[model samples]
Target: MAGAQMVNSHPNVKKYLGFALLPQGGVSIGLLTIVAVQMTQLYPIIAAVIMLSVLVYETMGPVFAKYSLTKSDELYGLDKLNESMFEEDTEN
Candidate 1:
């Protein structure tokens, strides 16, 4: 939700796209790694995928932090600034 506008307008779309995809990809890869670990033949491939997923998770930390900072106060009620739920639209 945070990057919806940036998805279309960001100069380096690929970088933003990668930022968006990393978490999803990491989870999928992590699942695959679990399944691969159960099978004996895919050990090497799964190990590499697990490592890649770790890197992906690391890359996603900042993107996650940015969204968390924006929404944390609203979601957790840590502060009460502008608590109106039905403000009139001021923008055209």
Candidate 2:
């Protein structure tokens, strides 16, 4: 359960929200590229939507998970120097 929890994330990190949305966008674009090149009349609207989703994803996904534990530990007082919890709050 602890592993599932998100802790010690930085302001520079995407906070998972941005990163999660990005994958959907990437998949949409990829599908759209394949379909658009085919130029079939199956569903142009669907392809367009996919491409649009990709644009949104790339703009947001890479923003998160930017900071690592090493960087946080080095600069910030992460995990109390020897604490395993990666604690940020003094009373958490």
Candidate 3:
């Protein structure tokens, strides 16, 4: 949030900042693997939570991104595509 604020305040290019909330499954899985190898006891609990988090995030990330883009009016091509598809379906 602070970083987004700083970017927005500064003369940098604007960004959707919400993208930062997206999950990093590869890195998390790698670290979790290390934990599993080194600290076997804590691995189960940590792995379960992290895996669940990753699953949820992965599932919802695209939805959130689409919502953000739609809210920002940046999905012009997608909107057009959907309209064209709808028109084609109706015509058929």
Candidate 2 ranges beyond 4 A from true positions = 1-26, 33-39, 65-92
Prediction 1 global C-alpha lDDT: 0.55
Clashing pairs for model 1 are none
Give candidate 2's error at residue 9 in angstroms: 16
Worst 10 residues of 2 by lDDT: 64-73
Tens-digit lDDT string for candidate 3 (1-92): 57657656422213554653575677878889899999998999999998998898888877777775666556685878899999999998
The lDDT of each candidate is: 0.55, 0.52, 0.73
Candidate 2 local lDDT, residue 66: 34
By TM-score, is 2 or 3 better?
Answer: 3
Kindly give the number of clashing pairs for every candidate. 0, 2, 0
Please state the error at residue 33 of candidate 2 in Å. 5.0
The model with the greatest lDDT is 3
Error of 2 at 75 (Å): 13
Weakest lDDT window of 10 consecutive positions for candidate 1: 83-92
Estimate, for each residue in 14-90, the C-alpha lDDT of model 2 and write its tens digit.
23334333445645666767776787786578776666766765665555323332333433545356565545455
TM-score of 1: 0.37
Best by TM-score, which number? Answer: 3
Q: Rank the candidates by lDDT, best first.
A: 3, 1, 2
